[model samples]
Target: MVGSCSVRFPINLEYLHRTHPHVTTYEPEMFPGLHYRMVVPKVTFAIFKSGKVIITGAKNKMDIDNAFNQVYPILKSSIKITEIL
Candidate 1:
């Protein structure tokens, strides 16, 4: 199956910075919150406020799903997965 979804997990800036050191972190005033930019092999992930995570530039769907699952527990019930453009 060609899985398509984006998962958002609630997390604080401190934790994100500590965990994904390889990813770049940016704070834009227009967004009015903190955000993270991560480039992992064949995928790119962007984490934003309200626990909204945007995963793009991926080579395949499985890679996105795996990344989502890996961070699923972090946000617990606050996690949300969207399967659409």
Candidate 2:
């Protein structure tokens, strides 16, 4: 009951910012990526403009799945269901 995972994908910062402003913060001087936290899965995700995602603080894979399920659609209206998980 301990660990985390990382994911890499492509997304636009302007869209992400437009979509989820309340849940993210970005300051290039402090960090290069946008930091986000998911409340349902209790997971933390570091989302970069390059679409590289690092998901941490998940206790199990199910949590990861839940978080992914919750986040995927927010960025994109549809699901591709490829390699990132």
lDDT of each: 0.51, 0.66
Candidate 2 lDDT over 17-58, as tens digits, reads: 556778877666788777677888888777765566778888
TM-score of 2: 0.70
What shift in Å separates residue 37 of candidate 1 from its native position after superposition? 5.6
Q: What TM-score goes with each of the models?
A: 0.52, 0.70
| Model 1 agreement with the true structure over 28-72: per-residue lDDT tens digits | 545533443434435555555455666666567777777667655
Clashing pairs in 1: none
Q: Looking at model 2, report the run of 10 residues with the lowest lDDT sum.
A: 76-85
